[model samples]
Target: KYVPIENAKYTLTERFVDEEGNEISPSVVKGTDYEEGSEYDVTGDAKVIDGYYLKETSNTTGKFGKGDMTATFTYAKLGKIIPVDPEGNPIPDAPTPQYPNNPTDPGKTTPDQPVPEIPGYRPEVPSVTPTDPGKDTPVKYVPIENAKYTLTERFVDEEGNEISPSVVKGTDYEEGSEYDVTGDAKVIDGYYLKETSNTTGKFGKGDMTATFTYAKLGKIIPVDPEGNPIPDAPTPQYPNDPTDPGKTTPDQPVPEIPGYRPEVPSVTPTDPGKDTPVKYVPIENAKYTLTE
Candidate 1:
């Protein structure tokens, strides 16, 4: 008599995934049908993958039972170490080190990464610790206490034109350090310091500038055609307000002289360090009139 035999079907599905259950590599599947009482071993780890390592496994070694079985292998992708500022922005030109793909122990930190040196800034942490795969480790950097800055001194006239040479001093002081540019202002001839802008302040992240605005202090002198001072010519006084752009002096009326008529009725000074001429010509005698 022929005996009826029962058979068992089992499926071994090997999956490579990350901690977040995302597959890093393709799945390997195999299936077989065996006798109900047959013993089978079909689950194991997968091959090495670039930039990924075995993290955990399920059903590494299991017997083929009446029901289907599925096995899986999870992996962890190496993480990257990034340098950043205090605001969490990535630092420019900074090195980004990656964690070892096959660490001796999973979920543990890898070797410390070297922190790059940044000019005028200090790293908050000397080194970086690379942790869990697929995550970034940030190294913060802050401004150094002794960082130097530049200060520019400018002496300009009311029209914003430089009256004196500009002084540029770089890498002189640290941030927030107080500085005084009052003494640096020059004593320019025919001009006086009217006001100042950003002349005195504490240094900051950007370059500092000190502008000393000056106004012209000029006078008017009257002279003759021979380039000699006019005898008894009234001196025109400059206006008291130096901020005036015209820099005009009060008009001076011609003085009365015997047997002379002044060339001009009045004289007005227009330019600084310049002379305005006023001539006195001899008057001609008028012929006597005979008519009644």
Candidate 2:
């Protein structure tokens, strides 16, 4: 008394397209009632979607007699370029750029990127064009306008040679700009200062010296004709090695004035403002020979 056995109606669609199909999410049908030939299957769920990147997928395993079946999942869009530093602040390693998803026109404009040299920085724009293929595209950078240096006040002489002539002081000074050069130091006759290089520095990027380093000034006084200083006279015999020109004060021996006759039999040591005099005079001719 039994006679029928019918049941066949399976459908399954999942589509999330956008390579050109343009639908980007929302489409998930399913209907079931299969038994015609008895064999069926369906599975699809690529979904993560933000900047998109799943490329392609269409035949998601099926056999419900082939009546309605879709699966589709194709997406592509993601192009970043960020490199800021004018206040936007993001130039740490600074070399980023990746783009390759413009199926027809994600807004269209991508093929230029090559602006990464940053050694003192200065790049408002030299390359980078990606107009929104999925966001993130900065590129700002700016900090290189310093090129006028020239602050050289050097007068060196501890051995670096060049004892004078090198002034220039300020020709314009840039790059952080704040030089002092210690008031441009220069009285240098017998030399003194002994140590300094870049004196007070702040300006950079080329041309800037500052070095003062002198050293060569000793004493050896015994002056009296009128120049004064002859009270004790021996305390001033220095120059052990101030750059040894035979060490200076070894011949300073004129200190005996009982009847007075010293016009300069021994004091000769120049340089420290030139002072070489050991004068005494008052012995006018007196010869009395008497042999016992």
Clashing pairs in 2: none
- How do the predictions measure up, each by TM-score? 0.36, 0.25
What value does the lDDT take at residue 210 in candidate 2?
80
Off by over 4 Å in 1: 1-11, 18-23, 29-48, 53-56, 59-62, 86-89, 92-95, 103-109, 116-126, 143-292
- For model 1, residues 1-292, the per-residue Cα lDDT tens digits are 9564455455666777877988877887765554444564543346566677666777756666566666677777666777777898987666676666544444344566667676556788787666556677877888676777788888898899998888895557777788877766566666656788887899765467889888866544455546566666565544442444324445656555555566788766655434556676656793444667
lDDT digits (tens) for residues 1-292 of candidate 2 = 9654456465667788888998988977744554445454443356656566566677656555535566677777766777677798887655666654434433343467666665446778888766555566888887667656577677878788988888787777777888776756666655566567777968644456788777766654555567676665453434443443223444656666544566767765655434455666555674545789
- Candidate 1 pairs with clashing backbones: none
Winner by lDDT: 1
Tell me how candidate 1 scores on lDDT: 0.66
